[model samples]
Target chain A: MRAALAASVLLVAASAAGWWLTRPPPEPPKVAEDQTFEDMDRAEYEAWMQELGYTD
Target chain B: MLLWLAVLLGMRFGAEHWLPALAAAAEQLDAGESMPVPPKPTGLASLPAPGTPGDGQRATLLSPATCEAMVADLRDVCWQSLARQVAPADPDEALRVCARVAGSEMVLECHADVAESIAVADRARAETICAAIESRKWRGQCFFGSGLALAETDAEYAMGRCAHAEVYQTFCRHDVVGEIALVDLPAAHAQCAREEGDWLTRKTCWHGIGKYLARRDTSEAAAACDASTAEWRGTCYHGVGWGGAERDADATLADCSTRGPYADHCRHGVAAQFKRADPTRAVALCESIQKADTRARCLDFVTR
Candidate 1:
């Protein structure tokens, strides 16, 4: 009876070890949601246009 | 015995408990937190000493603080070199120094500042610098800078002339044109008209003259247009026709009559005018029309 109990415990521990060893690494932190690219105004647009020599 | 075997196998496979225990023992010995210390980064020992020849030359070699210091030193050196040699007694030497320094962004900015200072000290020196730079491959920059300097010094004609130069046209004609408009509209119009073969130049010239006319006398505007080429004349007549049509139909017709190839357009415009003024007069005008299209358009105008 004691031998059978020991075998069951051994199997459970073996499975846990296997699962832990094969687990994927933790993911990196997420970027902030507020970051964006759409942020220029009309004056900035005109300045760029002038720099590029567009008259109209 | 089975439980012992399982524990040994588990340790062989994967376990963090042993790591924490070892970390705790180490920290206890060292009297610190029970956390594993990270190893030093690779290549830290290979770096040269600060202020050494190769220490700050490359970006990757310096730490952030050291990099900032190196950049500051480089900027100071560049400024000193620019101030010293950018205004050499010999024009050619000054140009050579400026060109050499222009390779660096900081030095190029310094050179510009130094050039402005020289312009203020002696206008002749500024012109000489411009002439010297004109011979270099960077003639466009030379012309643009000189034109701006001259414009600032109240040399309107010279500024316009410089703007019309090939180098200035390539780099800054649009900007120069704006400055020219504020200083001398007639000169600007003349310059643009002279470049008539180029469609853009012709259009810009016509537009400039048109704006000038909007605020000036009609006779002056007419003279400006007359001085232009055939294409510009057409443009002027078209503009005047639009403006006149809005104010007076008869005046629009008269303005359209001044240009040919547009005679059909003029006839139609006049026919519409007459219809608006007097339908009977429009029908009478249509009677003597030669072209079938013109006559048909005139009849439609009068009937409508």
Candidate 2:
């Protein structure tokens, strides 16, 4: 009876270890929310545009 | 005994799955790398349409109340128009009007615009006005704008005034020389020749020609660039690539491939121009470049 109990525990431990080891990597961190040009007031919009070399 | 056998078998299978991930994560850690987060795509649809009516013309004087009455989206422009109108007769009033602009940066930009407008009447006063700005960047921009306005009548004097622009000096020369090239190609080329010692100024000078002049005539642009000294020819070709890519990227890439020794630089230009509009395509194009250094350069510009 004791031998059977040990075998059962050992099987469960091995299965758990396998599951833990085989899990996929966590998803990548999310990017920050984007602020559209329309969301910006005129100054911010123009500065962003200028930075992107559009106004030149 | 059966359980022990199953455990060994499970561990073997688990190792297969976990090893690669561990190796990958370890490699990342070793390289001091994190997961790359791509920037969000910018919204370009709302940008103001170029060449709107009265786009470059001076606006008539308007009371502050009139400017205030304009839509919030356009009120700053109205304020700038008022400043420009007031600048010639009373620059101090123009500066005060610029102060009414919503943001500090825009206020400075308005001041720069007023200074440029003043340059049309009195270049010396424009210089004095530009020099008074506290921020170095805005002060440089002011000098550059005024210098550009001065270039219309006196290119050499305008170039001299551009020297006060500090870091923006090359940009001012680029436009001023570009403006000169628009009318006289040879004179622009000669001006660029005088900048031989300074790599940045000389390259940007040729770049201006490719940007402002090459777009008008491809064969002429090619010939003009071909006439450049061997050392700086690649930079001129890079400009041509930028100009060409702005209109048609695929066509520019095709042209770049035919450029032999200058091909990589041309490809770099095209990739840079396409970076904002189509980063994936830019990256793919970068991968196609033959030279490793240029390919890396192209990737750096696009991926960042």
Candidate 3:
């Protein structure tokens, strides 16, 4: 009985390892919808243009 | 182990290529075909030759120095970027910036912008800023400039102050109307439609709306003018034709041609526009104009 249990545990571990190795890799992380502006000038310029009715 | 290695390697390649791909996308987005044009911006009228400053260019920071350095198309970007950068944190400094600019017109533009910025905090000082301007020619610019900036936030108050101005009151109203139409067409229409002012003021207001409509929503131009009073409708279409003519002569004719009296005027405008490129074609256009007198005038104007 003890020998049978040990062999079963080993078999399960090997199968799990094989599945992990074979599964498709995750997709590259997606960019966030609202990324921060690159700089203060860009942020300020965009805000002013919005006020001028040039942007939504 | 091999699968894990492949996944990690794929991510590394993606990371390495990400910035370049983003940069390429950015370049394409900025292409002229994709540039977002707002409705009826008189400022954009200067886009073709952004070297010269135009109305509604009030918000740009393109000082004389910067403007001189840039080519025509890039100057618009310069104007867009710099509008708020050199705005006066102090009233005196604002004056200094204006003073540094050489031309009287530019000085007035500077003061007008500065005055408007100042008015946001202190209305009296803003007036004082304009009052300090030395040239009479620039006075109108200052008053209208302040009014234009004020219209962005407080249209009613800006209009009221412009109306109250001792001098340049008409200019004040016309310019304020131009800016207001940019934000709310119906409200501007109602304000302009009120029979309180002179015929010219009302007519000019409609013209301002026409210019706005021509830029913002091309399809709405005729409908908007159709809703106006008969006296000013032609005037409105005149500006509409003017705006359309900027894009194409055919666009002008298509937009402004009517069974109405303004048809000749609209044709004349197109001829004038065509005159710039092909004088012979412009003269041919003039001959097609219905009114004999206007046709003669257009022919002479184009030929000369």
Candidate 4:
């Protein structure tokens, strides 16, 4: 009876190890929320436009 | 057999827990709650039909009380119309009226945009209008806009006018020179030869020139880039690859080998360009990449 119990526990442990090893990748790093590709020229040009409730 | 069954069960159990977590995270990202509220645009959109009388213009024609009423409804449109009508007649007068209707920032922007608008046809008038601006910063912005407009009609005039924009000289030159150089390399180079300043500043203009010129004559553009000083050749060469990615992926990918540090960037750009239209070709191109990591990424994108 003791041998059977030991075998069962070993199987469960090995299975858990395999599952952990094959887990999915970690989440990707998030980009900044307020990121802007525009240079100063465009930024200044668009600030007032944006302030007036503009899109596109 | 039972051990194999346990392994399979373990895999299912792990997926059940982690899959939900991953999915929740993904949904959060898709919702875009991380980004700030996007600025709403109302100025041009709020304006009345083009060519038709804008509400602000009609308001001014009616009376100051009517114009004030228009401002109560739509301040941006009201001030914009007042700006355009009053600017031609009296720029200082336009600023005063626009200030009353809008915030301090918009007031300044109104003056600058108005000056530049007039500058498109008459640079001198724009300069004169800028002189009347109360603040130095507003005056520079006005002059910069004037330079940009002047570049469209005459690059030489833009160069001369941009020179006088002391606070915004570098930015003004970049805007004007970059604009002219995009379509007219000869004009840009001709001006660059005579006017000597910081090479870094001039590189901004040449970068756009090389990108445009590559579409017309790749070999000549490349040759011209080679003849240029080392100061600007890297960006100039990058432009060639960038332009090639837009129109000729194969040519760009083949040229990548000659570019050492910039090779992967060029190849990836080419791969991305071809990936959607002809994925088989994109996968084939990815196979030619020497960098293991870059190749893996390209393969994943094309295959996905």
Highest TM-score against the true fold, candidate:
2
Clashes of each: 0, 0, 8, 5
lDDT by residue (tens digit), candidate 4, B1-304: 7778777778778887678766776686555422222111011223343246664564355334556776354766667666766665566677677677555645666777678656654567788877777665566666767777666468888777666555445445545654566556678677655435554456544544455455555555565556555666655554555456676756766776666764654465466456556665777877877778867866765554
Q: Write the per-residue lDDT of candidate 1 for residues B169-241, one digit (tens) a residue.
A: 4224433443454456666665565663345444534533432342233344455556656755544433333
lDDT of 4 at B140: 62
Winning model by lDDT? 2
Which candidate number would show the highest DockQ if scored against the true structure? 4
Ranking by TM-score: 2, 3, 4, 1
- Per-residue alpha-carbon lDDT of candidate 3 for residues B52-125, written as tens digits (9 for 90 to 100): 44524543535657855887655544433343334534667556655655444445556766665556556778
Q: TM-score: which is higher, 2 or 4?
A: 2
TM-score of every model?
0.32, 0.63, 0.53, 0.47
Tens-place lDDT per residue, model 3, A1-56, is 99888766665555444433333322212222222112224433333322222111
Instruction: Give RMSD to native, each candidate.
Output: 29.2, 14.7, 22.8, 12.5
**Cα shift from native, residue B197, model 4 (Å):** 2.2
Candidate 3 - CAPRI tier?
incorrect
Candidate 1 chain A minimal-lDDT segment of 10 residues: A28-37
Model 1 TM-score, 2 decimals = 0.32
Candidate 4 regions with alpha-carbon error over 4 angstroms: A1-56, B1-74, B81-97, B211-230, B239-304
Residue-wise lDDT of candidate 2 within B16-61, one digit each (tens)? 7788887877776444343322111111112222245553354434
Worst 10 residues of 4 chain A by lDDT: A47-56
